[model samples]
Structure formats: C-alpha cells, structure tokens
Target: MAKIMLVDDAAFMRMMLKKALTESGYTDFVEAQDGAEAVKKYGEENPDLVIMDITMPNMDGLQALKKIRESDPDAKVVMCTAMGQEAMVVEAIKSGAKDFVVKPFNGERIVQTVSSILGK
Candidate 1:
C-alpha cells in the first residue's frame, strides 16, 4: 500500500479524494488543509505521494511542491486543479510534479494517475 498525502483547503475535497483513494485500494493517507500544513506534514509523514491542490492559503501547491522537491529531489507529487488553471498546471509540471488531476474529482482517473505514477 502506498502512503499518500491529500492536500486541499476544502474539507469536502479532501474527503472526496480520500474516499476515492480508499475505494481504489489506497488506504494509507495523510491529509492537510492547506499548503503550509501540507509542507509540514510532508516532513513529518514522508508519504509516498502527495495529491496537492493548486490554489490554497498560506503557500499554494506550487510553492509547496518546490519546497518538497528541494528537500527530497525524488518526491512524487500530483497536482490537483479545478478547471481553468492550465497555466498553474503547466508551472507545477515544470516545478517537478509527477502528474495532475482535474476537479471536480474523477475517481477512476485519480486512481489511474496515482497507479501510473507509483508504477502499480
């Protein structure tokens, strides 16, 4: 099982992702409400993968992704973006995110992306 981190300001989004991941056989999870918390939890938990939201308070996903990458060059992150954030997604890819998933949440796509990234 992979230890995954789900980072989003919205509790609903986190819950949705968690549910989807759990249903997909990914049970181990660490959740953060925002980028600052995500960064802190990343260090404490060292999860295998991070599913991060692009827009968040106190840092945002891109900045957290950069910080995580700086600390662990091999850190695997998959950015989550709502529709219309193409530019941010591109920037995230440039900054070292392993992949991306768009919202409003497609459970299968999220699982597929995660499985692909983890080579499962």
Candidate 2:
C-alpha cells in the first residue's frame, strides 16, 4: 500500500483517479490542485509516487517536477497529460518523471502503469 500524490486542477479527474487507485489497492493519496501546491504537498507527504497533470494553474507540472527532483532526485513522478503534448511530455521525462498517463484516462492502463512503477 503505497501512498500517492495526485496533482490536477480538475476535481473530476482527481476523483476518477482516486477511484481507480482505490480499486487497485492503492489507498493513501494526497491531493493538490496546482503545481505549487503539489510541490508543497510532496515535501510534506513524501508519497511513494506522484501523478501530476502537465497543465495546471500556478507553476505547472514541469516546474513542479523540477522542484521535486531537485529536492529528491529519486522522486517517482508520472505526469497526467492531454493528447498532443509530446513536447511537454518529453520535457517532463527529461526533468525526471518516471512515466506519464494520457488524459481521458483508461482505468486499466492507469492501474497497470502504477503497478509497474511500484513493482507490484
């Protein structure tokens, strides 16, 4: 049971992800609505993994990812992005994200990716 931090501006998206994570046996989750909050929460929560959206109010995911990576080089992050954000996605990877999930999330894929990252 790994703790996860979910960063997204959309409440519904967070809810959907929370449900999927719950169903997959991932119970601990910390929620942040924007990148600045994500960075703050990451420091306080120190979750096992992070699921962050690329587009967000305040700092945005890439910036948050950079901050987190600077704080902890081994931080495991997975971006939640919309379609056609390949450039941003590549930048995220370069900035130290472990992986990413596309928008209009697929429950099965989400579960699988998280599981794979957690080595479950």
RMSD of each: 0.7, 0.6
Clashing pairs in 1: none
What does candidate 2's lDDT look like per residue over 1-120, in tens digits? 899998999999999999998998889999999999999999999999999999998999999999999999999999999999999999999999999889988998999989999999
Q: Model 2 reaches what TM-score against the true structure?
A: 0.98
Q: Could you give candidate 1's per-residue lDDT for residues 21-93 as a string of tens digits?
A: 8998999999999888988999999999999999999999999999999989999999999999999999999
Give the least accurate 10-residue stretch of model 1, judged by summed lDDT.
98-107
Error of 1 at 69 (Å): 0.4
Estimate the TM-score for candidate 1: 0.97
Model 2 is weakest, by summed lDDT over 10 consecutive residues, at 20-29
Off by over 4 Å in 1: none
**Can you give the TM-score per candidate against the true fold?**
0.97, 0.98
